[model samples]
Target chain A: MQITTFSFKRLLIYPVILIILLVLGFTVTAEKQPAWFQQAQDEAEQDGYKLITAHEMKALYESGENFTIIDVRPEYEFREGHILHANSLEFDLGDKLELKSDKQAALIGLLGSDKKQTIIFYCRSVA
Target chain B: MGYQNVLRFPDGFFGWKSFFSDNTQSVDTIKKLGIGDVFPSCRLVMLYDETDRAYLKIQSLQKSFALEDIGNPYLYIVIYNEKCLACVDEVQSFKALYKSLNESLYLSDKVKLLAIGAGSKKRGVIAFKKENAIPYPLFADENRSIFYCLGNPVLPTSYLVHIQPDGRRQILFVQQDHINNVEMLIQKIYSLVKDMELPK
Candidate 1:
C-alpha cells in the first residue's frame, strides 16, 4: 500500500512540476517578445484580424485560392516590384487607426459587396 | 469594417521582395530622365487643392490638371507615393522648402511647388493631404500614367524645371533621392534660380 501510494504521488508531483515548467517556459517566451510586437498582436486579436507569415502567404498564393491580396504600399514601390497578382489599393490610416470615410467607401467598392471574402493587406512592415 | 475574414501579412512587401530577390528584374527598364529633357505632359486628377479646385467636370467632381497649366517660371515637381513613409518625409521637406521660397522676394513668385501622387487615388490623396497639412496642390495619378510617362523613376523623385517662355519645360535638376539636408536643397534651388534672368 505504501509503494502504491508513493507511485501515485510521484506521478502527480511529476506532472505538476512539468506543468509549472511548461507554463514558465511559455511566460518567458512571451516576455521575450518586443513591446511593439506584443501590442500589434493584442491589437490584431482585438480587431479580429489574423496575422499570417510570409511562407503561409506564399502557400496561399500558390494554392490558386479565390482570396484577394491587397498591397497597401506606395504605388512607386508596387511599380518597382510586388508579389504577382496582388492588387494595389493604397489608403492612408487615419489618426485613430481607422480608414477615412471615402477610403472606406473605396475599399468597400474594391472589395465588392462580399463581406465573406478573404482579404489580405500588407505594406512595408508589420506596423 | 464588417469583413470577418480579414488577414494581415506581417512580413509585408519587404519580406516578399527578399524571398524573391533572385527573381527580381533590373531597374534599367525604366529610362531615367536627365537634365534638359522636356517634362512630359500628362493629365493628373487633382485630388486636393489649398486655393481652388480646377474641376474638369462640374457634375462628376472630377478635377484634372496638367503640368503645363501652372505658368510659374520655375516649377518644383515632387513625385511621391501616398503610403510611402519616406515619401511623406520628402513631401514635408519640400513643404518647408516651399514655405521658405514663398517668404523669399526673388524665388517666391517664380517658383511653384507641386506634388504628384504616384498610383494614389482620390481618397488616398485627400487623406494624405489632410494628414500632412500640405499647403500646395496635390494630384493623384491613379493609373500611374504620369509615373510611367516620367520613366517610372524612384519614389519622391523631385524635378526642378525651368519653364521657358516659348512654353517648353527644361528639367534643371533631378533629385533621385530623398532630401536629407533641406537647407542645402534650398540653397541649391536659390543659387539655380537667382542667377537666371527671368523672362520679362
Candidate 2:
C-alpha cells in the first residue's frame, strides 16, 4: 500500500493530539464546587453543629431552653409576623453587608456583652 | 452527607389542622407583590453568597425578605405551616416559641396581606397552587441553592415577589417554618427588600 504525505502525517499525529485533548478536558470537568462550599459544609459536620428545623425550634421553646433567635430578614418584614421572640438581623440575599461594625453592635444590642448565650441563628432556610 | 440542618414538612401550616387551628390566623392585609409585567432589575436580588451570610447584625431574621414598596405599596403575608412549625408536644404554643424570631409580614403600610397559606406542600398545592405561582416558588430547595443564597429557609419557604417603591420588581417576603423555614422566611424577606432599595 502506498501512503501519501498528507495521510502519513495525519496517521502519526492524530492519536497524540487526541490523547492530549482528553487529558485537558478531564482536568477542567473535575473542578466543580468552590472551595468555600466544602469548607462550610465540613465545619458544620466536624463541629457537631446541627441545623434545627422550625418544628425543632418550637420544641426548644416548648422545652423552655434559653436561647436567642436571630431573624435575618428585613426590618419591615420583621414587624409583620416574626417568630414570637426572634430578633431582627436584616440583610439582603444577594448583597453583602458590612459586618465589621454590625457584628459589634449586634452583640452589644442582643446579648448585652454576654457572648455566652446560646445564640441560635436562623433565616429562611438551611442555607 | 449529614443533612442535619434540613427538615421537610412539605405541608407548612394548613395541613396540621388541629394544633394550628388556634395558632393560625389569616390576615386580610397581605397584598400581592411585584408588577404584572416583566421581572424587575437584578439589583434587588441582594443575596449574600459567602461564608458570612449570617454575619449581618440586624435585629430580626424576618428583615431578609420584606420590603416597604413606597409608591405602589404591596403586602406580603408569612404563612406558617403547622406540621413544619413545631415538634408537636415539645414546642408549646407556637406564639410562645421565639422571642426574637423575625417575621417581616407584620411590618405593614407599605404592603398588604392578600392571603396567608401554610401546611404541607401536598395540601398547599390545592390551596396556594391556584394563586398563580407559575414558577411555583416553594422553599424546598432540593439542591439547597435557594437556602444557600438566602442564608436559611427556616420559616416561609418562599417569598411572594413584588415591586418596590423605586419601581423594581423583587421578592416581597415568605412565611417559613424550617420544615423548610416556613415562618422565618417573612423576616428574611423584609431584609432582602430593604437591601434592594439600598443605595448602590
Candidate 3:
C-alpha cells in the first residue's frame, strides 16, 4: 500500500514539472515578440485593426479630417511628447483581459460606440 | 443628430510639436480669459524645504506672500497636472520667457510670473517643480477652487492679472492652450501693462 502511494506521488511530479515548463515556454514566446507586434497581435485578437504610420497620420491631420487618436504609451512618454490632440491611455502589456474590456470601453466612450467611426491606437512606432 | 467624424493624432503632441517647430503651433482650442474674473479661494501650499519635501500653506506661507504676491500684476499660468503634455511644453516656454525677461533690461521685474497647479496636491506639485526646474513659485490647489473660478478652462491656461496699487487684482488676459508665439505673448502683455499704466 505504501509503495502504491509513493508511485502515485512520483507520477504526479513529472506532469507538474511539464506543466510549469509549458507555461514558462509560452511566456517566453510571448515576450520574444516586439512590443509593437505584440500590441498589434493583441489588438487584432480584440478587434480587427491595422497599424498607422506617422506620415499617414500627418496627411490625415492636414486634410482636416476627423478621427480619434488614442496614445497607448506610458503617461510620461505621452506627457513628454505626443501628436497634437491625442489622449493618453496607457496599455498594460501584461493585462490581456483588460485589453478587451476596460480599454475597449474607454475607446468606445471616447469616439462613440459607432462601428464606422475611425479610432487609432498609437505607441512609439510600428517599425 | 449623431456625431459624424472622429480622428486621432497617433504621433501625438511630440509629433505635432516637431511638425510645427517654431513656425506655427498646433493647439487644441483657445479660450479667452478677460478682466474682472476672480480666482476662487482655495487651499494652496508651497514647498518649504526642497531637501525634505516640507511644505507650507499659502495662507500661512509668509508675510511677503500677500495679495500682491499672489497677483496684483502677475502672469499666473495655471496647469492641470504634470501629465498634461501641452502644459509641460508651455512650462518650458514660460521658462524661456522668464530667462528672456531676466536678460532684458527694460522688461525686468515688469511683471512677476507665478504658476498654479489646480488639482495637484503638495507632493505632485513638488515633483513637477523639481523635475522641470521651474524657476517660479508653484502652488498646489488641491481642491481646484481656482480652476473652477475660470470656468474650468482647459489645462495650461495663462492669466494676466492686473494688480492695482491698492492690491485690487483683476484678470486682464487669458490664453487657452499653447501660447503659440512667445514674441506675440510678450507684446500682448506689454500692451496690457501699458493699458494698466503700471511702471514699465
DockQ of every candidate:
0.30, 0.02, 0.08
Q: In model 2, where do residues sit more than 4 Å from their true spots?
A: A1-43, A46-49, A93-98, B1-30, B33-200
Order of candidate numbers by TM-score, starting with the best: 1, 3, 2
TM-score of chain A of 3: 0.54
What TM-score, to 2 decimals, does candidate 2 have? 0.30
Ranked by DockQ, the better of candidates 1 and 2 is 1
List clashing residue pairs in candidate 1. Answer: none
**Model 3: docking quality category:** incorrect
Fraction of true inter-chain Cα contacts (below 8 Å) kept per model?
0.62, 0.01, 0.18
Over the full model, what C-alpha lDDT does candidate 1 score relative to the true structure?
0.74
- Arrange candidates by DockQ, highest first: which order? 1, 3, 2
- The sequence of per-residue lDDT tens digits that candidate 3 reaches over residues B1-200 is 14333333344444445556432233233333456765443434446434212211223334234445442245445555666555776787888776765565655556666677877787888888888988766877677667656655656677777666666567787777466677777778777777778456
lDDT per residue (tens digit) for residues B10-89 in model 1? 66776677776543332235676868898887766555442534321112334655556665778888888876666876
Off by over 4 Å in 1: A1-127, B1-28, B45-63, B198-200
- Candidate 2 vs candidate 3: which has greater TM-score? 3
Q: Name the lDDT of candidate 3.
A: 0.61
